[model samples]
Target: MNELDLIQQLREGDEHAFKTLVESYQDLVYNTALGIVQNAEDAEDISQEVFIKVYRSVHTFKGESKISTWLYRITVSTALDLLRSRKSKKRFSFLQRLFGDNNEPLQEVPDFNHPGVALDQKENAARLFKAINQLPENQKVAFTLHKLEDLSYQEISEVMKVSVSAVESLMHRAKQNLKKILEKDNEE
Candidate 1:
């Protein structure tokens, strides 16, 4: 069944249709969450939350856009909420350090892949992910939904609740930023 048909079935309270919908879009939702959260465990939690929200609010989704677009919106919003919560915690920790005399270093150990792994495409992918991380939130969302998720400009615009032209602009800027970062890396 097409997405619209599946949505209609879901609206009609068909449990099987809901399962099919979840099965179809689960990867997209999970990956999007993973990109934003950058942690597998948190992404899994956020992905489940996205689907629950989608199932409960599916009735409010007027068919103005594709079901995938609606799903993307939910996924992005959930991830953003998680990011905000993490930021708040970090800020609180920083404030606590300012008031307390505990001089423990805040360290994050990088998880190194096996040294036997060649630095071919993996390095490029890492560079690309780093560059994507540096993008402003809106541009990052547009770029992630477009290049990473392979959503069309129209679909992203609907998901982001922006004009198609605006999405195009954000994507263009994102590409330019990535290109500049890559160029600077090459020069170094």
Candidate 2:
């Protein structure tokens, strides 16, 4: 079915349509979330949240962009929200440990192995992901969508609600930042 037909069915609360939509875009949503959040479990949670948000707000979708673009925006926002909440929780936990009676040690999260990466490239991919994670939020989003998700500048602009030139600038800055970050890592 065409996107408009799918949207129409979704607006009418058709479960089958929703299921089809989920099946069609689940990989895209999950991969985008995984790329940003860098954890399989967190990515799965964010992907579910993205679908819920889509279901709740499908009626508000004005068809200003492609359905895929809308889904991309939702996935990015949901992943970022989860990341921010995780950061805040970690900060709160640290403060609690410092001030209170809690004696639990913080566990280190292992490096995420992206399933799409080749076996030989896994180590390099991990390092790249670490560098990407250090980027400012906007640059990170642009870089992930462009490099990982293989999105065009126009598609990223639509998803980010920014101009194409702005997306280009973000990608350029992201590449420069990644180079510096990787070089610094190597020198250490």
Candidate 3:
């Protein structure tokens, strides 16, 4: 069925439709959460919370935009809110111990099952993720929605509740920041 049909089913309180919706977008939701929280555990928790929020609020969706667009907006908002809450905690001693002052020399995760990812690729992904985590919240969200999720500027602007020009500027600055970080990593 089409997304509109699925949404109509959801609006009619079809539990199966809700599950289908969740199953379809769970990865997008989880990855967005992961980008914000920067911890798998917290991301998982926030992803669950996002789905719950969606369940409660799905009826409010007016179909003015695609359901995916609405869901992306909800996902990004929830993730950013979680990040903002974490920022108010007053300390990052845990991170200090994990990444240390220099930020190079990331700890490795042994994933024997995924030979597609070379060790270097894994390390690079980790470093990239760490760099992303350091970005200002808006830039991080903009970058993740664009770079990681492969959403277009129009889609991202809709999700972020920003103008297309604003999304373009955000993406431009995010690329500049990420390039600088990668160049520094090369030197190290």
Candidate whose TM-score is highest = 2
Q: Write the per-residue lDDT of candidate 1 for residues 1-188, one digit (tens) a residue.
A: 98788888988989999899889989989888777666678879998998899889889988887877788888898898887887797777777778885455555524322222357766666677777777888998888777657888988888898899999899899999999988987899
Estimate, for each residue in 131-156, the C-alpha lDDT of model 2 and write its tens digit: 99999999999999988899999989
TM-score of each: 0.83, 0.95, 0.78
lDDT of 2 at 163: 99
Pairs of residues at least 3 apart in sequence or in different chains that clash in candidate 2: none
| lDDT of residue 137 for candidate 2 | 98
Tens-digit per-residue lDDT, 1-188, candidate 3: 89889878988989999999989989888876776666777778888998898888888988888877887778777778877776654235446547575454444433222223467687677677777776777889888888667889998888888899998999888878988988887899
Q: How many backbone clashes does candidate 3 have?
A: 0
- Candidate 1 vs. true structure, TM-score: 0.83
Candidate 2: what lDDT? 0.94
The alpha-carbon deviation from the true structure for residue 46 of candidate 3, after best TM-score superposition, in angstroms, is 1.4
Please say which candidate is ahead in lDDT: 2 or 3: 2
Whose lDDT is higher: candidate 1's or candidate 2's?
2
